[model samples]
Target: MKDLELLLKNIKNKALLPVYFLHGGESYYIDIAVKSLENDVLTEDEKSFGQTVLYGKDTSIPEIISLAQQFPMFGELNLIIVKEAQDLKLGEDELKSLEFYVENPVPTTVLVFAHKHKKLDSRKKITKILTKNNWIFLSEPVKDYQLAKWIADECKANQIKTAPNISHLLADYLGNDLSRIANELGKLKMVMKEGQELDEKLVETHIGISKDFNVFELQKALGNKNHAAALRIAFFMGKSPKTNPFPMIIGNLYNYFSNIIIYHTMHGQSPQVMAAAMNVNPYFIKDFAESARFYPLKHATRIISLLREADLKNKGLGANQIDDAELLRELTYKILNVDRLKVSV
Candidate 1:
C-alpha cells in the first residue's frame, strides 16, 4: 500500500519512469496505477498521437517492445499500456526479449504492464530486473481481518467521517472486494450532508445491509449468550438467503469464535496487545473480551467444529436433505448452547 501511495505521488509529481511492470493478484491497484500513468503522464492533445493501448492476449512481448521502442510522435514522451498482461504467454524467447527491453528501456517511452489477478514468478530474471530498478508494483490482496481498517483509512483520507463499528459492519457485508467497497464509499460520500457522519442507519439505508440483523449483530448476540436474540437474527437471515448467504454466515461465525479462542490465549494482556494479536481494531477488543468470557477457549474451539459441521451439511455432505435455513437455525442453536453440549474440545 505504501508502494501504491508512492507511485501515485510520483505520477502526481510528474516524476515519470521508463517501464512500470505492475503485476499483482489484486486488480484494483493495478487499474488505478494504469489509469494514473495513462492519464497523468500525457497531456490531452499529446495522448492523441503519443499513447497506445494493447492487451496481452492480442499481442506479444516482442510487439510490445517494438511499440515501446518508438519515439513520441507529438510530445516529449510516448505511453504504451498493456492491459491484462498476465494472459500473455511468456516463453523463454519472450522472457529474454522482455528482460532486454526492461534492462535498457527507451527514455522517450513510458511502458506499463497492467498485470492482474496473478503475480509473475519471482525467480524470473525479468521480474528481478524490474524489482531491482523499483519499476515493479506488486498489489497483494487485503486480508479479511484488515479490511475494516482499510475502509476506515480510506474514509479518513476522503474526509468522510464514520461512526464507530461502521467500518466493521461494512467489512462484514462487503467482504474483501476493495473496488466494490470503494464504489460504495463513493456513493456515501456523494449523498452525505456537508458535515454528516456515516452511521449504521445511513449505511443500512444506502448499502442495504441491515444494521440489526447482520452477522456482526448476530455475533454480538451469541457472544453475550442472548439465545433468543441470536435465534431471531439467524431466522431473519435464513429467510433472506440472497442477502445472507449460508456460507458467508458460517465463515463469519468461524472467524468470530476463532478470535475468541485467541482472546483466551491473550487474557490479561493490554487491549492493544490483544487487538494486534487478533488482527482486529482495538475498538472491538471489549467485544472479544466479553465473548471470550462467555465461551471460554474450549467452548469457542467446539463452536468452530460445529460451524464446520454446519458448512458440510449446507453442502449436502450429510445434511439429510436439510435446507440452508434449517441448517442455519440448527447451527445457531448449537453455537448458543455450545457450553452445555458435551463435546471434546
Candidate 2:
C-alpha cells in the first residue's frame, strides 16, 4: 500500500496511476483522497463524459469491468470507482471472471477500489491479486500512543503549530479517532495564523475543554481518591458535550489504571521506568505513582469494570434513564468509596 502523503503528492503532480486500490483502518485519509480525485482529477464535464461509481454489494465484477473498458467520450480518462470493495464476493467461484479483467484492465480508464475497514487477510489470494497488478493504498488508523504525535504533525501540516500541552489535550479528548481529530483540528487551524502557538485557552474557547482541565490532572485527582474533584471534573465534562463522551473518558481512565497496574506489578521500579513501561509521558509519572499508592491494583480494576458498565448503560443497553452526570457520579462514588459497594478491592 502506498503512503497517503506520497499518493497525494503524486496526484498533485498529475501522475495518477490506473487500477488504484485503497483499503484500511484510517477512513480520513481515504476520504480525503477520494474527494481530491473527484475534484482535481476529473472535472464535471469529464464526469459527464465517463465516470461510474458503484458499491461492491450492488454491482457484479463483469458489470464493473464493462464500464471500466468503455472509452472516455471527450476526456483524458474515464474513472470507474468501486466503493466498499471488501463486500464484493472474491472466491474460487468468482475467480475466473475476476481474473479475466485483472489480467487485462482497460488502459484508458482509471479504476479505483475503496476497500474499507481492516485490511483483508494477507494470506488470502485476492490480497496478492490486487498487489501484483494494481496500485494499492492503506489508510490505517493511528495507534493510541502515536495519536498525540499525529495531532501535532497534522497541525504542522496545516502550517499551524500547537503548544505541546494542547497536542496532548487534543489526543486525550479525541481518543483513537483520527478522522474526528482531523476535522476538529481543521476548525482550530482556521482561526490561527502561521507560527501561532495554539494553547489550551484557544482550544477551550473553540473545542470546549476547560483551559485548566486535562488528562494529567484528571488522573491525579482519581489517584488521590478525591471524590469531590473527580465529580467536579466529570460534571464540567458532562456540561460540555463538545468535550465529553463516556467512551473517551473511560478509555483515558483505563489507561490510567493500566499504568497503576503496571506500577503495582513491578517491585522498586522508578517512576521513570514505570512510565516508560506504560507508554506514558514522564511528566505524568508523579501523579500515576501517587495514584498507585492510593488505589491498589484490585480496587482500580473494579472501578474500571464499573466504568465499562456505565459506558454500556449510557449507550442504551442496560439503563435508559441514567444521564451522563448521574452515571459519572455513580462511578465516582464507586471508585472513592470502594468498600461501600460491599466488594473486596
Candidate 3:
C-alpha cells in the first residue's frame, strides 16, 4: 500500500515513472492504483490523443514496443496501459526485447501494467531488473489477523470514526475480501453523518448484519461459558443458514480457540505483549484473559478437534443427515462439556 500510495502521489504531482508494473494476489489495491493513474496521468483534453489501452491477449510485446515508440499526437506525454499482462504470450527473445524497452524506456510515455491475481516471474531477468529499479509494486492480500485493523484504518482515512471494536465486528461478519468490505463500507458511509462513529447498530441496520447475534457473539458466549447465549446464537445461525455458513462458523470458532490455546501457553505475559502477539486490540485482551480461565489449553485443544469434526460433517464426509443447526448444537454442547476435563494440559 505504501509503494502504491507513493507511486500514485508522484503521478498526481506530475512525477511520472517511465514504467509501472503492478502485480500480485490482491486486486483491490492494484485496481485503485490503476484507476488513479488513468485519471491523473493525462488531462481530459490530452487523454483523447495521449491515452491508449492495450490487452495482453491481443497485443504482443512487439506491438507494445511499437505503441511506446509513437510520439504523442497532441499532448506532452503518451499514456500506455497493458491490462492482464500475464496473458500476453512472449518467448525468451520477446521477453529480452521487453526488458530492453524498460531499461531504455520512452521518456515521453508513462507505461503501466495491470497484472492481477499473480506476480511476474521473479526468476526472469526482466523481473530482476524491475525489482532492482523499484518499478514493480507487489499488492499482497491482507492477512486474516490484520483485516479488522485495516478496516479501521480505511474508515479513518475516509473521515469516519468507528466505535470501539466496531471494525472488528465488521471483519468478523465480512471475512477478508477487501473489495467487498470496502464496497459495503462505502454504502454505509453515504448514510452516516460526517465524523459520526460507526457502531454495531448502524452496521446492523445498513449492512444487514445482526450486530446483537453473530458468530463473533457466539464465540464470546462459548468463551465465557454462557451456554444459554451460545445456544441461542447457534440456533439463530442454524435458522438462517444463508446468512451463516457452517464453514465460516467453524473457521471463527477455530481461530477463537487457537488464540485461547496460545494465551494458555504464555502464562505470565503482559496484556500488551499478548495482544501484540495475537494481533488483536489491547481492549480485547481482557476478554481473552478472562476466557482463558474458562477454557484452558486442554479444553481449547478439544474444542478445535470438535470444530474439525463439525467441518467434516458440513462437507458431507461420512456425516449424518442432520442439518447445520443440529451440528452446531451438538458441537456447542461438546464444547461446553470440554471444560470438565480441563486438567489434561
Best by lDDT: 1
Error of 3 at 189 (Å): 1.6
Candidate 3 on 233-305: residue-level lDDT in tens? 8888888787787888888788888888878887698888887777777787788889999987777888888
Over 112-168, each residue of candidate 2 has an lDDT whose tens digit, in order, gives 888788676677565677778646677777878888877878888888776656677
Better of 2 and 3 by TM-score: 3
For model 3, the superposed segments whose C-alpha errors exceed 4 Å read 340-345
Question: On residues 1-345, what C-alpha lDDT tens digit does candidate 1 reach at each position?
Answer: 447888998997989999888887788888888888877888899888999999999999989999999887787988999999988989999999989998899999989999899888999999899989998888999987788889999999989999988887888788888999999999999999998999988998999999888888889999999999999998998888888899889888888888899889888899999888877778889998888778878889999889888898988898699988889889889988887897654
In angstroms, the error of model 2 at 262 is 2.9
Candidate 3 structure, TM-score to reference: 0.91
TM-score for each predicted model, relative to the true structure: 0.92, 0.74, 0.91
Backbone atom clashes (below 3 Å) for every candidate? 0, 1, 0
Q: How far off is residue 170 in model 2, in Å?
A: 3.1
Assess candidate 2 and give its TM-score to the true structure: 0.74
C-alpha local distance difference test of each model: 0.88, 0.75, 0.85
